[model samples]
Structures are given as structure tokens and as C-alpha cells.
Target: MVGRKILDDKHGGKKHLYALNVQYARSEFLKRDDQVLAIRLQQEERLNARKKAAVDIDRARAQAGQDGEPYAEPDPDLDEDVPMDDIAGDNFGSKTIVIHVGSQNLRLGLATDALPKTVPMVIAKKAQRSEADDSEPRPKRIKLDDHAPSEEWFGDEFAKEYIAMAQDFKVSRRANKRRVLPNSRELVTKWNSTTPPETIPEHSDPLRIDWTELPANEKAAPDYIVGAAALRIPERSRPRYHLYWPVRHGWLNEKDYAGRNMLERDFFLILEDSIKHELGLTHRREWSQYSCVFVIPDLYEKVMVGMVLQEFLRDFGFQRVCFIQESLAATFGAGFGIACIVDIGAQKTSISCVEDGMIMEESRINMKYGGYDVTETFVKMMLFDRFHYADFNLMRRHDFLLAEELKGGFTTMSDENISVQMYDFHLRAHGQNTRKYTFKIYDEGVLAPMGYFRPAIFDHSDKLSGRHHLIPRSTDLYNGHPNDPLSKAQMAVISYVNQAIPSAVTAPSAQPVRPLATPVAPTPTKNRPLGIPSHLNGDNDPTPRSSPAASPPPDDGGTPHPTGDDLNGDEIGELKGAQPDTEIIDRTVPVMPLEQAILTSIHHASGMDERKRRDLLGSIMLIGGASKTPYLGQYLEMKLRAALPQYPKEILVAPPPRELDPAVLVWKGGSVFGKLRMTNDSWISPLEYDRLGSRILHYKCIWHW
Candidate 1:
């Protein structure tokens, strides 16, 4: 029964999927007076019955003089292995791998696995020593060829080395301080005995050392560090090491080649390591057998970037590769076909509408409001309110981490004034002192995440101008005053049409208007269609014909015969007359608020008629780590409902499942999809790609078009 309930909730219930007679009902049972009263009486009677039954059971037990064994209720919460019949059949023999590379994380695992192994998508360069340190003896290099290659560290191992180096520096500094004190005292005594006390040299304060700059190695060598290790570097040492993020705002950073290369190298290493770890394979040849699927943001489909990524993967020895949109993957993972996905990622938020496995690209909106933006807002608010004395540059990382913790804690609270204690050593007055400072966050904690839904509160003053291009202006022909010239012209045209209708029906017979003596035929131009002169072929026709042709006589109206040339000319005139003269708006508009952004995207999706729009408005799904902000789904639902109040009450706001991490849903969905035999057609084999080129992706990936 428990398994059935879980399956029903996830798969939308068998009835919901197959019911043929589903009806829309909006009756309010609670509003009926008799029904309400009956419900109250029924609740009271049930409570009394439960109490009476408990009393009778106690009396019976007492009469029995002690039961052989106390009846124990079944443990509903106890773990139970789901029967094979209830679980999806496993096809582990298939050689497929799924990888989801997000702005914040990289997830990879086999299709048979329920989840993917995730790592941070960041790379840090190890700090390099100053040129002065070159004179020092260097560690012996391991020669692999004519010259030994420089050693490099990545992932967790790189972080461990940096941390250990920091620890050693701290311990050595403390020992140096202890030795300096006694030596200074001895020097003072000697000066007092040998020379006058007043002549003794004043003891210089211990020199302030920059621990972050201390060389970790004899030679000034820098290596790249990646994943969680990059984030573990000490705050002070961060400036010395260059941090590189390969992907930002759901796309590869094209401007920085070095950083981009480091990111690529890290990805390669991570992929190779993941395959070895998950599949338990050691040889490189074993990797060639598996196919790979990557889930990327929808924006990548706009350009040649997706093809570039495919080529990159091909270089990595994957036999086959497939691409899936992040939003579509999340919708599929959640077991839904039609949904408006709002993916709040680390650096950006993406809102897209998907229906029947097809993404509405026109309705997709990507904005620069996301989890990091919230953190930045929190930091700014704290600095403005309490930490005015501290340097923002030095305290940024420390406060960012603190703000993250505060956001998580405050999200669970209901109070308006929430105080959080944050400690930072950077707040110390002097290098010698180790003092901690506490920062108290108030309303800003809640206000920061709320910006996602009500962005007007957080938006810049310049951006708050509600100038929409679609809103019709008074200057528009339809909206103009009756006396305005444009309106008067339209009125004149309408009056002419009305008069022409009656005149044509009641007027006496009129003489036929003669066509102008065919203008002196211009000299024929070579290469013109049908040997017609360019001047007479509509390109440079001097005389403009404005009047409509006379209506045919009533007897001839049904069988009016016109020349092909006359028909062509009349059709051209009608086509030109049908077009409107509205000016096109410029594309350089400022960013919009989150609410307007979502609505604007929905408005532009192709084939979205009234019913489809209403259906999309009814199903909005919020996913990603940033979307986990408390009450976000409810807030979005309220705003969306208000935006389209005419929609049915069935509209729902699907928040990420509490039992699973929202950030990894794309990966999970990719895993599920990758395991299916139908997905085989989606995979672009290396040979196929080589033969057809990148155009094949347009057909294989549903979101590409």
C-alpha cells in the first residue's frame, strides 16, 4: 500500500493518467451550512467513539487478568524492501552514462544508477611564489622525457595540500613569536648594563607578516585545483591563487582561454575518474564502450555551442552522445509532460514552458537573478546596516559564507526580526589580535530571497520604468481620437466603403473607364522575366494605380473572367494593402522583473492559443537550489494567479520535492531517460555525426529547434 501511494504520487495516479470522464468541478462543500454543521457533528461523534472504545478495551483487559502478550501496532515507519514487482525493471547490462554539467555542479553516473555523483564546477590555481624564491633549492623533478613536466593537482587533493600548507604557516608563526619575546628581553638587560638605560634602543614591534604570501614550495610553481578543493582555499590566500569557473550563467565563458582550458581539463579528469570509480574499470579501452548523455541549459540551443560541446565530448572518446535541455529534463524527471519550469540556478534563473515534450523556445526567459544574487544582496544589506567600518573587499568571502548559512537558518523561521551571530577574524583591529565579530541580520534575510518573486523591491531605480512596447499608445490608429488625422483618414475610408456598397447596387449604367494607351513600350531589358521591360515589370513603374477595379455587372459577377496579368496585379495590390504600418521596437530594452519576465516568456511561445496558454499558466514547476527559498512556490503561484485571474482554480505551483535535492533533478531525469530503449534514436554516434555534421542534433534533440 505504501509503495502504491509513492508510485501514485510520483506518477500522477493511474486514474489521473487513464480516466476518460474527468470533470471540472468548482463546488464549495464547506460553504454549505448544513454540510458544515454535519461535518462538525461527525468529527465530535468520532472523537467520542474513540474514547469509548479505549475505555471498553481497558475494561476487557482488566477482566482477563493479564494478557499473554500485548498487542503491538505494526511499525508503519519501519524500513521494508520493496518487492521486485513494485520496482521498475532494471536493465543494467546496457552501457549508457548520463552527465549533467550545471553552473554550480557536475553530476555523472551510469543509466542504471538511481543518482549521480556530483562535484563543484570550479577550478583554482595554486598560489605561485615570488621571483625572489627562485634561488632556493627545488624539489627533484621526476623526468618522464627530455625534461620533466610540471606537476599539477586537481579536485580534493589540491585543496588538502593548500590547507596543510596554511596550517604549517600558522604553527611556525606562533613559534617565531615565542622566540622573539625572550630574545628582546635579554637584549634590553644587556643594553641596561653596558650603556645608560635611557640610551637603550627601543624594542621594535614584531614585524607584521602576510601569511598568505608565504611560499608553499621552494620553486614558484603554480598548479590548477578543481571542484570542492578550490573552495577550501584560505580567505587570505585566495588573492594569490586565480580562481576559474568554466561555466557561468549556464554557458561556457568564451573570453578567458586559460580559465576555459582549465575547466575543460578538469571536466575531462572528472569524467575519466567517475567512469573508473562507478564502473570499476581501470583500462582506458573500457571507456570506449559506453554512451554519454549531457543535460545542458536551453540557451545553448540558440547557437553552434551545442555542436561545439558535442565535438568536445567526441574528443573524449565517448562512443555516442545525446543532449537534453535542463528544463525539459527536470520536467521529465518529475514525471510531467506540460509544465512551466522556473530553474533558479547559482548565477541565473531560467523560466521555460514545455508541453508534450516540446519546449516553447520563444517563451523562455533567462535572467541574472539567482542564488548568488541573493547572497550578494544579503552581504550588501549587512554592510549597509552594521559593518560600515570593515573593508568590503577583504570581508566579502567570509561574509558570503556567513550569509549563506544565515539564509538557510532564517528561511525556516517565521519571525520578522531574526538575529544571526556571524564570526569573522578579518574584523580584528591588528594582525596580532585574533578577534571575532558578530553580525546580526534582520528583515533583509527574508527580503533577499523574496526578491526572486517581487523583484521590483530589489530592482534598480532606472529599471523600474514600466515602459512596455506592447501596450498600445494613443498614437496608434485604433486608439486615436475621432478628430485626429490618422483616425479621420480611417473614418473616411470606412465611409467610402459604406457608400461604395449602395452606389454599386443602385447606380444607373456607367461608361467603362478606358485603360491608358499602353505607355510607350520602354526598350526591352535583357534577363527580365518574360522579356518584359524592367520599368513595366513593377520595379520602376512610373504611374501608380490607386483605384479599385469597377465591380462586375450583377449578371457577370459570378463568372467574371480576368486576364492572368490582371489577377496578378490585383493580388499584389491586396497584399500591400493588408500590411500594417506599425514601427518595430528596438531590442535593447532593459531587463524586466521576475514576474514580468515569466509572463512575457509565456506570451511569446508559439502555437499557444487561449486554451494552451491557460493550461501552461496552470502548471508552473519551480526547481533548482535557489528555488528552495521558503514560500517561493507559494509566492509565485499567488503572483501568477493574480496575473491571470481568469484561469481555473486547478492551477498549481509544484515545488521541488522535499525528499530529493532539486539541483540534481536534471541528472536524475537524464538517468531515467538514458535507460530507455527508445532513447537509442536520440544518441548521435561519432560516425553519424562525422557523416552528417552538427545538423543532426536539430532533429535528435527535441529542444534544439
Candidate 2:
């Protein structure tokens, strides 16, 4: 019975399948479906719409052109009125020229604009034609005085050209060697060392000339290549060319005359280019209409300031020139009054404490630990530890640049292992191979910046003991003899007090019960005249009592007595005698760790005022390029909070506004300051500078004053 049931089920399934197949075949043969035709029609309509839209756009554009109102595309990056546009108008009164001169970059802009223009703080010499090219007529040069004007290149234009030429040289070698070349444009070599050499023909080709056989006269003048171009020249040729860095560690490089000359030349060109080309002010007469504000480092010497002022006044002939401290300007730019500003620059990190819009001079610390040091440390670690590359001489400027890029890239990632392909690096072990080397950079790459926070990571022979002293050596406490007259005075007071104390306890008082006689007639002193009746003396009398002096107030071990000038001569003498003759034990240590440096600065600035210290610590402003490092602000805040555990845990580390840049915070602040009408007093006119000399800056500059 089971077998018979199974056979019957199988037969029913086969019959059902046959019925479904027959039905599907019947449906396919029924008709052409409307759904398929509808889809096809929709696609056709979409194509026609697109074509019509294109035609309509072209027609509209043509019509707009015919009407003499051609369509102008709106730039998303620019505001309603750019700097150039604003300069064209007659409303130059509200505008100001703001310049922030940094060690690495230059930031310049009009106060009315939203952001400043940034350019490399570098100047390169324009390529000079060789003696062989003397036959060619020279182009007319722009003259500033009786002397012929020297050719120069400023900022990004020279940088771009240099980098392009360098890369072209690199590619040219590979192409000449029959190696795989990078996809670059056709090489065009310009004469007099200004451009890259043309692509070398095959050895068999007649056009191919062996560069090694070239005569000394035919060779490019190494001195002609300046700025970034200097990096591309062969090592042997670099000596002839002078690569001048006008500013180092945020001040004029006073070590040599060349640095000073380069600084002046670059500054002059920058002003000329901005006025003549950028703002379309060709005539020299138009320069007087504009006021300039220059942002300088906080720790600049007075002589440097004077030099800069002199240059601007004598050379550029600006109507007015103002100087602002970088830290103070950054504080204002960040929109904060009291803050601990940590500016990590390319070559140095300057920590300063600002309170109520004024810089606390005593609490400033400048150190040579910053982004450049971090890159150098990373490069060293990579060379010695990771790759073990023996040939350090082979490492070019581009290698360090690539290392910097790698360091920046490492900051943005959380991965422990960062794989970098250094195409330019030539590993001696992998001799003559064109293959790129891949390095797995781990802890060294990620923790290179740690040295900035931890000074011990770097080798320093002189161990710093206490808080670093930023004050000049001449005015320092330990500068003179330890047993100076001040110390002697303190000792004399102590000896006098010791001798008088025992006698005062043992000696009997002369005229003991004479209180009634004193009440009868009290002598009046100059501070309190006898003309005023006792009844006239109200509840509040600022003046001291004229009657015979009462016994000294008993010590309550609370607050110290007010040390004001109102104290009588006798009282002042007694107070001076009471002071101990203890030496000031110069406990200040030098070259402190970054964290301690910050805390010590605040401690010194605040002194015994706990409230002031707390206020400063509450608002820590971290600015500069180094501050852009990942987790730097957070790490600093963590360490700061840990060091100052007594303060509230939630200390606010205020960063610059999201729209602003930390590296250019000072520039932005300068721009803001220049725009405001209230800051007009800060501007120092050329006439005032000329009349009073550079000393006028000391008075006009609020921070300096």
C-alpha cells in the first residue's frame, strides 16, 4: 500500500509541472507588454530633456553675451568684495595692510578681508644671464634709487618654479638612462640656470652632448639659482649660491650682513608687489594712503625692532607703520583676554602668559624645540634605526620634505604601522635598482613630536635644573656678586633687630603713666592737620591719625600688612628692620620640560595670586603649526591638569575658532586689530618715527610700553 501511494504522488507532481510549463509558454506568446514600452519611452524622454537643457543653457549664454552682460560665474571661495575690488574703491580709510612675518611663512592681507594671504617667507635671487649670453640686450630694470635694481623672486612663485625644475631634473635622468619615466609634460630647458634641461636624446643621436665634457665657461652659474632653486643644484655648485634666511627663530638673523640684506630686499619687494601689482597702485604717491601693521615675535630685541622700523620708514616710505606682538595679537585673534599662549613655530616654541590684553614679560619662555626638530628627530630615527641607511650624505632636501609629509600623514592616522614608499631614496644595499623602497615606520614616526613635550628625549649636555630664565643676562639676579649691598643691608637690619629685641624686653619704659597728659594736647602732623576738628573726622578716614602713635598691631598670622608709601618714617624703619637677612637662593632651573616650562611661566606671572594663576590656566591657547599635531592640545591639557591637580579637573583649553587657522592666528588678530577704529592710536606714523626716532615704538606699542 505504501509503494502504491508513493507512485501516485510522483505521478501528480509530474503532471503539475507540465501544466505550469504550458501556462508560461502561453503567456509569452500572448502579446507585447506595455510595461516594457513605458520604460523605453521614459529613457528616451530623459535623453531628450538633457539635450534640451544643454541647448537652452547655450542659448541663454549667447543671449546674455549679445545683451553685453556676459554671465559671470560666482566664486565659492571669495566673499562679495575681494581685497582687489575693495582697493579699487575710494573707501581706503577703513582698510589696513596687515603683515605677519614668520620664520617659515609670510601672511599678508587687508583688514577688511576674511582671511590673509600666505606666502613663503623666502626670497630667491633671479637667475642671472651667463657671460656667454652677454651679447643679448638686457631688459630695462625697475629702479628704486640711483643704483640699479637687483633682480629677485619672492614667495610661492619662486618655490613653484624651483620645485618644478627639480622634479624635471629628476625625471630627465631616468628618461636618459632608458628607465621608466614619470608622466610629466614635455621638458623645455631655459638658459642661464633658470629652467630644467631639455630631454636628453639617445646616446646614438647626434644632439646628445655629454654634460661631463662641458667647459667651465659653458656651465650654469651656481649663484644664479636662489631660494628653492638652490636645493636642486649639485652639492659642489651650492657654495657659489647664497641661500639667505632673513629670519630665524622669529627674529632678524643678525648673525651676518647677508641675512639682513636679504630681509630688507625681500620686504621691499613684497611691499612693491602688493602695492604695484596686487592692489594696482603703480605710482609711488599712492603709498601714503595706506597704513601698514607688522606682526613680530614677542621676544624680539629692541635693535631688531628699530631696524625693521627704519627700513619701512626709509625704504618703503609707508605713511604709518605699527608693530604688534605675535602672542598678544594671537590672543586677540582667538578672542580671549587672559590666556597662556603656546606658539609652536617651525624652529622654536614660545610660551607666554597674557593677562587682560597685556603680556606678562616675566612669564615668557622661548625654546629651540618645534616642528623642525621633530622632523629632524624622525629622520634620524628612520636613518639609524628603521632603514639603517649608512649613506646620510645621499639624503637630499626632498627626502626631508618627504619625511615631513610622512610625519604629517602619520599624525592623522591611528594605525601603529605606517608604510611609506620613498621613491627618491637610493638604498646602497639595493645597488642601482630603480625600484622604490617601502619602509614600515612604526613608533619612531608617530612619536617623533614627543621630544617637544619631553626634552630629555633629545641630547642636551647642560641639564636644566629649575625654571628657565628668559630675562637678559645683564639684569639677572645672579649676574652680580652674591654679597652685594642689598644683601649687606638685609644683614644690617637683622643684626639691628637682634640687638634691639633683647633690650626692648629688659629696658623700663620712661614716663609710663602719662596717658592723660597726651590726651590733653595731641600734636598734629602734616598728613593730619589740627585745623580739622575730631568731630569732622567721619567713619572713613584714609589719612593716618595725628595723635601719638599707639602700640604696633598684634600679628594674627593672616594676611601680610599692606606695604604702601603712607607708612610714617618710623614705622617704615621698624618694618624694614623686621625683615630677615636670608639670601634669595637662586633656585630657578634652566631648560625645563615643555609642561614645566608652561607651568613655571604661569607660576611666575601669577606670583602669589592664586586667582590670577587659575584664570590663566583655565584658558590655555595653543597656536602655531606645531599645535596642529594630532592630540597635541588634548595631551597638553591632560599633562597640565595632571601637574595642577589642585585646580578644577575641567580646565578649558580653548583652541582657535573653527574657521580660523592656528598657524596664522596672529595674522588674523593683526587683521582684526587693523580694521577696528579703536586701534588707530596703535598706528605709528612715519613723521612721528622720524621726529622721535625708533624710540617712538616703545610708547606707541602698548605691549612694549
Task: Return the top candidate by lDDT.
Answer: 2
**What is the per-residue lDDT of model 2 for residues 50-168, given as tens digits with 9 covering 90 to 100?**
56556766777888889999685422221122223321133443456788776666677777667766655544343343211222111111222324212221123322433443354
Error of model 1, residue 513, in angstroms: 51
What candidate 1 gets wrong by more than 4 Å, as runs, is 1-94, 127-222, 235-240, 255-283, 301-313, 392-400, 411-435, 454-590, 606-608
lDDT of 1 by residue, 308-400 (tens): 445445666777777787888887688788888878887678778888887765555555457765665554444334343223332233334
Model 2: clashing residue pairs?
Answer: 466-589, 467-589
Give the least accurate 10-residue stretch of model 1, judged by summed lDDT. 580-589
Clashing pairs in 1: none
lDDT of 1 at 554: 26
**What is the Cα-based lDDT of residue 149 in candidate 2?**
16
- Worst 10-residue lDDT window, candidate 2: 467-476
The per-model lDDT (C-alpha) reads 0.47, 0.48
Cα deviation at 182, candidate 1, in Å, is: 57
